[model samples]
Target chain A: AQSVTQLDSQVPVFEEAPVELRCNYSSSVSVYLFWYVQYPNQGLQLLLKYLSGSTLVESINGFEAEFNKSQTSFHLRKPSVHISDTAEYFCAVSRPGGYQKVTFGTGTKLQVIP
Target chain B: EAGVAQSPRYKIIEKRQSVAFWCNPISGHATLYWYQQILGQGPKLLIQFQNNGVVDDSQLPKDRFSAERLKGVDSTLKIQPAKLEDSAVYLCASSLVDSGHNEQFFGPGTRLTVL
Candidate 1:
């Protein structure tokens, strides 16, 4: 069994400011990590994923996350944020194989203030 | 091309009532999943299907919940006697296959409110 823990329940960042949403996981076996975003009234969308590759993974929208095996963490970060970046973010963990279900954290609400 | 599709964007019912949600996955997707998203909580997997066969359903409340994916393309989740705690958003997601490289795409979700 795997569980994800999101440190922050909500984050308020000024437009064009930097932000980071912390995520940690507990699992005995190897795992894959993912970040998903959900805008208001929308479904969850893939933001970025960390499989077996470099420690860092990035999304096209200027968001990135680093997989830290030692820390058991995969924190999502962005150098700058736009008003449109306001959304709920989730951190998930999945087994590194086929037909595995991803377990998600409670989620963090990012509020980009102008 | 198209993302996952779910029906009846919203449903309101009383306790002990029966409710069902429909979902149509993306074309050619071989994996489907049903999740429940409670307020202020993350989505929890209720059932997962791999081309009409059950892959994982350990978390599903089988005594009251049932789901099926006929033809492996579309799926339905039903609750025979809904409880107040069942009031949440029901989401459907699909992946080409549950491979390492593939990702799950989600639908808009059906918000169910039990009164």
Candidate 2:
């Protein structure tokens, strides 16, 4: 069985400041990692993903996540954030084999303040 | 390309009552999934389907919950004798394929409040 853990339930950062949302997972086999952002009343949208490339993956919207194999972590980070970046972020993992069920974290609410 | 669609954005019902929700996946999507998300928690997948066939329903509470993607397109989920714990957002997602690179597109979930 695979599981995802998001250490922080909420993170508040000033506008233009850097932020990080921590994510860790446990799986016996190879895995795929993903980050998703959800706005109020909207469905979750894919922010970025890590499959089989370099450990570091980036999103077009200035967000990036590094897949740390030894630490079993895939933390999302952005050098700077905007007020519009405030949203609920979810970290998910899909382990190979089984039903390929993608397990998600509890979520971290990022609040960008002015 | 349009994303996945779910109906009845919100529904409130009394415990022990029955309720049903609907979902329509993106055009040509071959995989669909149903998830239940409780407040302040992650989404728990109840079932997954590939076309009209069941792929995984290990977490589904079959005693009270049932779902079907009859024609391999749109789908519906039903719950009989709902319990208070069933009050949560039911989400629907669809993917182009059931592969390693599968990127499931989610629909705005249907919030169910059982009184």
Candidate 3:
């Protein structure tokens, strides 16, 4: 069984300020990590995922996340945030296999204040 | 390509009343999923389907909730005796494959409000 924990429920930051959303997971086996974002009035979309090869993964947007195996963490980060960057971010985990089920965190609402 | 589609964006009904939501996955996708997202909580997987076949439904509340993917394309979820706690967003998603690395496309969830 795999579970995700996102410590922060909400985060408010000024425009152009750096931000990081913490995410930690518990699993008996190695798992894949993912970051999903949901804009207001929009459906959830996959921002980035960490399958293998690199511990660090980046989205098309400026956001990036690093998968730390030892720490069991996959924290999302952005050097600078824009107004449009304000959205709900979700951290998810799933085990690698034929039948995969993704488990998502409660989510962190990022409010980029201008 | 067209994204997933859901019907009845918002629905409100009294407790004990039945309600249903529909979903149409992206063309050619074989895997479909139903999730329930309560306010202030992340989406929880209710059931999963692979080409009209049931894959996982352990998390679903079998006593009141049921879902089906009849044609390997469209799916429907229903709550026979909806409770107040059932007031949440029902999300439908589909993926190209049933792999951990596959990306699932989500639809604009159907928000159910129980009065």
Candidate 4:
């Protein structure tokens, strides 16, 4: 069984300010990590994912996350945020094999104040 | 290139009532998922189906929650004798395959309000 922990339930940042949403996981085996974003009244969309290759993964929207095995963390970060970036973010984990039984965190609501 | 579709964007029912929600996945997706998202919480997987057969349903409250994907394309989730705690958004998602690296596309979700 795996569990994801998102330390911050809410994050407020001014426009163009940097922000980080912390996430950690506890699993007995190697896992795949993913970040999904949900805008107001919209469904969740995949932001980025860390499968195997390089520890660092990025999304087209200027968001990035690094898979830190030693730290058991996959924190999502963006150097600058726009007002449209206000949304809810969720971190998820799953085993590397076929049956991708994913586990998700409570979620962090990001508020990009203009 | 249609996304996952769910019916009745919002549903209101009383406790102990029965309700059903429908979902139509992407055109060629072979995998479907049902998730429960409570307020302030991330979506939680309740059931996963590979084609018309269930792959995983460990988290589903089988006593009251039942889901089926008869033809493997569309699915329906039913809750009998629903409880107040069942008030939440039910989401439907689909992926081309049931793999660890594949991304899942989600629907807008059906918000169920139990009074």
Best by lDDT: 3
Q: Native contacts recovered by candidate 1, as a share?
A: 0.66
Off by over 4 Å in 2: A97-99
Q: Candidate 1, which segments miss by more than 4 Å at Cα?
A: none
Deviation (Å) of A46 in candidate 4: 0.3
Write out the backbone clash pairs for model 3.
Answer: none
What TM-score does prediction 2 earn?
0.98
Would you give the TM-score of chain B in model 1?
A: 0.97
TM-score of each prediction: 0.98, 0.98, 0.99, 0.99
What residue pairs are clashing in model 4? none
Estimate candidate 4's RMSD in Å: 0.7
Write down the lDDT of every candidate, Cα atoms only. Answer: 0.94, 0.94, 0.96, 0.94
Q: Give stretches of model 4 more than 4 Å off.
A: none
What lDDT is obtained when candidate 4 is compared to the true structure? 0.94
Docking class of 4: high
Residue B25 of model 2, lDDT score: 98
Q: State how far residue B103 of model 2 sits from its true place (Å).
A: 0.6
Q: Model 2 residue B40 lDDT?
A: 97
lDDT of 1 by residue, A81-107 (tens): 999999999999998777778999999
lDDT of 4 at A11: 98
Report the Cα lDDT for candidate 3. Answer: 0.96
Clashing pairs in 2: none
Question: Tens-digit lDDT track for model 4 on B1-115?
Answer: 8899999899999999999999999999999999999998989999999999999999999999999999989999999999999999999999999887789999999999999
